[model samples]
Target: MGFHSFESPYDWSRIDTYRRRAEQCPGGLVDLSVGSPVDPVPRSVKEALAAAADDGQARGYPKTAGDDSLRQAATDWFRRRRGVDLDALGADLVPTVGSKEAVALMASLLHLGPGDRVVQPKVSYPTYAIGTQLAGAQVTTVDDPANTDSWVDLPGVRAVWINSPGNPSGQVIDRAGLSKIVRAARSIGATVLSDECYAMLDWSGTTQVGQNVSIPASPCILEPGVCGGDASGVLCLYSMSKQSNMAGYRAALVAGDARLVKAMTAYRKQVGLIVPGPVQRAMRAALEDGEAVMAQREIYSRRLRALVQALTAYGYDAVMPQGGLYIWAQARSGDCWADMADLARMGILASPGEFYGDSHRLRFSSTISDDQLELALERLHTGA
Candidate 1:
């Protein structure tokens, strides 16, 4: 009841009120709030989906576990990008319709109810807590999710949610920080779910500090240094929405801990929650399209850099994040809603910090179109 839900008037309603105010500005609204991708879907992914549909492969129901090719592509991605070698049999990997549902349904899938507790980051993707509540489980939050002692020691803690290149903050936890969490959670028999949806979008050149893991972006929970190569109760969720511009395709996967994945697969099948057959093929193409992913990263990097510069000049304390598709910045006004009001005056709409549990800063998404971003930047610079 303490947290906002739709029935209780979720933050979106409040944010929307601000949005409407922005829409009334004489210059017209240039939305910098929503993180939906405006980029084109990778050519390879589109080709694969079209091929599947044209070949009549989309006529039947999809396997909830995902086809072997889709699952294998996931494992291969883990090995190539995450530097983590999952099970050779690859039963540890399973496709998800999209990472959001997987995240929202995680606690329910585990059948966790009232006496159980789920720990999540104070400012993270909201679905983690939503899922816990849907399962009738208690929710706890920590400022630093990778600090195991902060939540792992809590009584009856059954799950800990970790988001590297975290939402709203874009902070990445290195291997040592994550390893401590993994070890502590495992010691107490709690499941650790790492949301790595933005894994491929790091702008921070931060290293794995004390480890030799050559991960492409953020250090993954399934990495050897973090999990000690044993995925007993770890689950890493990856989404292609941002990187491959495949949000509409709902392509993503859960990989790690064969038993956990196997159990989730069973439950998913019962509910008919399978990725469409065409989407499954598209996911395979997306995973294999490293060039497209890298290209998208370059595009976002430029936009984020430009936004940071423009915001700083416009009296905001701005900097490129460690990783993720957002610019986390604090405005001259100090108050988040006040900053939103200031942006609204310029016909710009950015997410108020309170929407993501942060009252000190607003989030500007890099998923905007370049011309609109340019207009937003011009407005900020001129204080028009």
Candidate 2:
């Protein structure tokens, strides 16, 4: 029941009603409300998974800490792609079922509970609050995390969650802003968990803060500049779901703070939260295939361009996201439900901002197929 205190489920009946209404249109429905990938899996990843499965090694229980190859691949990925150097063979990382599992369990594994506080962005992925509440911890929403001073002094604050190329908003925090939050959290003895799942999908190659600029993907919590090359009291979570179209494989990992990772590994082992061995092997293959990842990014980029052009022509204020898979946009009237109705009438469906702690915008995902995207664009153009 306490979990219900976090937030109510989205009005799916409303979505269903809209779905039925939209189906009556000649173009059918183009659901851009969710970011689930519609593309095919990379051949390398699929082959690797098939090979591992044929080997029949999955009959045995897999290690909760993941195998050495997987860990090393993850380390190499951070260094090569994210500019964060993690230990190649140390107990500083562990594979997770998915980033969602890690996000939801981090608070509980850290032993946060009643009377403690978990600070998360006011407009964020809903799971942050759910995880805190599941741990019996209170949630403190921070509207402007760039202003670290606002949350640093909050009493009982035990953990802070930061998302880059943030969901819903698609805003990437700069290196200096991340450093300030990390420093503030460290000063108060709280752990900072940076969710960098969308780090590699940065639309803007560089993040600009005034005149100073840095690679958008390199401002991770584990980045040397962000944490002074010290991973103490900090952790970074990443997922291959978005980057590699491996969401069904549940491939994700948490790295940073050897002690913290070790503790999480031990707890997860006892609780049977292990990644499938076959999935682990597939993840390794996915991490090593940089070409496939880049190609996928370009596909999404094209879709983004199409959506922005069409939405702009329709008189909607389409916010060009710096990164991530979704386009955050606002109706001229600033009424999300009105926008939702308009979209439904055009046989389109987008996630309303109300679902992500905002009430005046909608999120359009770029993960749809090229044909589906074209249909959505045509509808937008014709005001169908």
Please identify model 2 stretches exceeding 4 Å from their true place: 1-6, 9-14, 88-91, 207-218
Compose the digit string of candidate 1's lDDT tens values, residues 1-384: 122232221357677766888889876789988899999998999899988995544887778888888878877777787777787423388888899999988888877888999998988777787888888888898999777768866899988998988998999888888899888998899999999999888767855422233435888888777888788888899999988999988888998888888888898898788998999999999988888998998899999999999888888889889999888887568888888887887888898877777778899998888898888888878888
Candidate 2 local lDDT, 306-378, one digit each (tens): 8999999898888679889988887556887788888888999888888788878888899999899999999
lDDT of 2 at 147: 89
Q: What are the lDDT scores of the predictions, listed in order?
A: 0.83, 0.84
Clashing pairs in 2: none
Q: After superposition, how far is residue 201 of candidate 2 from its true place, in Å?
A: 0.4
Q: What TM-score would every model get versus the actual structure?
A: 0.94, 0.94
Stretches > 4 Å off in candidate 1? 1-10, 88-91, 207-215
Candidate 1 residue pairs in backbone clash? none
**Model 1 TM-score (2 dp):** 0.94
